[model samples]
Target: MEKQVKKKKKKRCSKVKKKMISSLLVLFAILLAVPVVSAQTSLNNNVPSSNSDATLTSEEQKKLDERTIILKEYFLNVEMAKAELDKLKEAQSENVGPRASLVEIDKKIEVAALRVEELKEKLPVGLEKIQTAKESGNVSALSSAADYAITEIQIFWDSTQSKYLAHTAGNFTSTNWKKDRETDPYMTGWRDFGGYDGYSVYSLHYNINIYNPNFQTIHHADHTQYTDWTSTASTYPDARGYAWKYQDKGYQNWPIWMTDWADYNNWRQLGWYFFDFVGGKPSGNASFSASFGHTWASTTINSISYPAGFGWSTNSNRWDKGQSKAFTF
Candidate 1:
């Protein structure tokens, strides 16, 4: 049964990813390059799956519904962003507005679109476990399987950038991390980079996937990755990032953090993340200031003394950025 669940999870994640990608193509076509003849553009309203399974409790189903609505909003936002981008392009060409203002709007649109896509990817991946349990027509087991479906997905995103005097260019942390993307619910990938603060962080782990499944339980899967420093010091530094998901079947996030940061004894937890199952909303800003690390070496703020860091940091001037999304299906 577990094997079947894993296999189904793999397939479902792939489908969800493919859909995430395909939607943007249309968004670009209708919103950016093209003109809107009708103000009402078609949107991917992620209606509640019509599947009539008794596997989920009313509470469980409610959580799922909220995520569906969230996705619908994102789809709408993309359409709107596209329209705005189009207008900016037109204004730039016709000299209708200040070039700087148009450029600023264009950057905002890109950030928003990237955020929406990251959330979409984290939501539906590894959902077929619940489906497989439902297919068995066993509501009791499905009750257990409900835990297989994460109720609240929280993400701590990574932002990586670099600066030399007044010039700064980067934000490739997203793309660079993408070089070794893994869809599996359980895996880790590492690459060698420079170290910092006299710590031997020769290699950095860009990806961390937690595939926690037990007899039954539900806990948010939270993830945090770091690129503490660069080989050379700078007024500004670059770091990149991506989103992370989590799970719990008698699992604790602290252990993962402990294991993840075993190599860095003196490092500060620039920021930390802690989540509970009470309930959560899907908005990009929940943990937006997270990322690989920084371009500068200012004594990492948000220091919480030793390995007991959980929750976000109080300081917020760092150039770090990342995105996270929660969902149900």
Candidate 2:
């Protein structure tokens, strides 16, 4: 009975030892697996495991994109500024009046251009590096550089536009003058005559011939007389006969002193017969006239005519013409 009890106790002790060993093994495995799992979770959460080389995050990529946009905007602004500055320079040169302010504007444009160049130099890399980074999709660095470049460009453009506005305003205030002259001669006749308004004198002349029947010979003489006359009457009476001749007989060889020669008998009794008359009718009557005149008139009364009133002044002592009112009260 004593031996059997001892054997049973030994068996129970062996079984207890086996169970303790199994529990220890399971506990050790759980400890080791905990560290490994924690390490893997930390690495997965922090970085992309698929490509261990990649270091940039989504936030970083977004920032790079924003910077790139800014850079592009600034660069475009710089180009715009340069164009505006060039236009201002052209306008300044073409302007006939004073443009002292335009020099200052040009200086500003040059300074802006220099600033842009400086910004470009300050960027991280040379052209090659930027191109490589761009091709590689490293947008963060590229965008940051672009932001700085664009800022410089925008400043330059704004300054250029301001100066351009000032130049345009000056040109707007400026004035211009031009002169023109008439190149054709005046046409005047009994039918229709055209003449300039401001002309001083308009003269016309016609030749005359006389026949002496009493002397039994032809007495031919030519004389020209000019008058400030216009068209003649459409119908007039013949001077040689008692009956009135209704025809277009232009005035010829009529004395200046004699008036009221509308009567045909009165003109004939005075020995004044129209030349080129066939059977008491006018045949070859021809005349020519010339006119002279002024073309332009001045705006100010002081420059109306010439010499005397050209540079005259009013009671207010103001310069009327040829002087700009800009920058002066």
Candidate 3:
């Protein structure tokens, strides 16, 4: 009885598997027939088929050809009009045209702009839409507009011509060597170039520093001493430039100063350094100035004497004069 039951169950499972296979076969057949039916319907209805490599109807082909011709003609006209406008500009710049030529050139520029807009409008849609319409051969209601604006470039150039001078003093001497002394001359001057609210500087040459100065002495108690003299300088395109304005300008500009401090010993005890800025902006009257300071100190000892065995007395211990060089642009 058990063996007979098992055989019956196996037979039922096989029958169910056959039914599933048969259903899949029918579905596959229907899918295969769908494209063939669609092609027949497209032919009967006289409509362009979406199937790959399907040929267009005569009317559709004619319409496509007309659009292609229009596109070619507009492209040609745009190129020609652009060329003519450029020629007029060149002629005007060379002073070849009469006064009336200005009016004529302006009119020509307007016409060129209109021609560009017309050419742009011919496509009516973006590249993706244009391709879709071309494939479907249906372009009955398509339109577009063009927006063009003029960008102006204003040039400016100026330099500091006036001579404004300021000075700072550096001098300290003591008999007893057991102290620290410092001299810092904050010397800075700036002149407005004026006339430019916003600008870019392509070239510049400036001079701002401490000049004609004697070195103060730092005497050690044991007759050993080091003369103290040091300086620094800087130039900024826009020192007082507003922060928000730089965001639109697309760059951040801080003061551009000398990286290393100008040190002065016996041989070198004077001008901080010169500046040559190539490209910078914030056009208009730009103010610029520099400041300097110095310090002198003696090493601490048990006891020291002044004006006796120190053996150092010079008239160049003080800064005599401060001057500025000619600035150029």
| lDDT preference between candidates 2 and 3, better one | 3
- Residue 225 local lDDT, model 3: 24
Worst 10 residues of 3 by lDDT: 242-251
- Alpha-carbon runs more than 4 Å astray in model 3: 1-60, 122-329
TM-score of each: 0.19, 0.19, 0.20
What TM-score would you give candidate 1 relative to the actual structure? 0.19
Tens-digit per-residue lDDT, 210-282, candidate 1: 1100011001111111221121122111121212211101121233434332121111222111112112223
Q: Model 2 misses residue 140 by how many Å?
A: 32
- Give per-residue CA lDDT, model 3, range 122-197, as digits (tens): 5422211101212223212111111111111111121121111111111112211111122223322221111111
Per lDDT, what order, best first? Answer: 1, 3, 2
Candidate 2 lDDT by residue in tens digits, 294-313? 11222112222221222222
* Root mean square deviation (Cα) for candidate 1: 24.6
Most lDDT-accurate candidate = 1
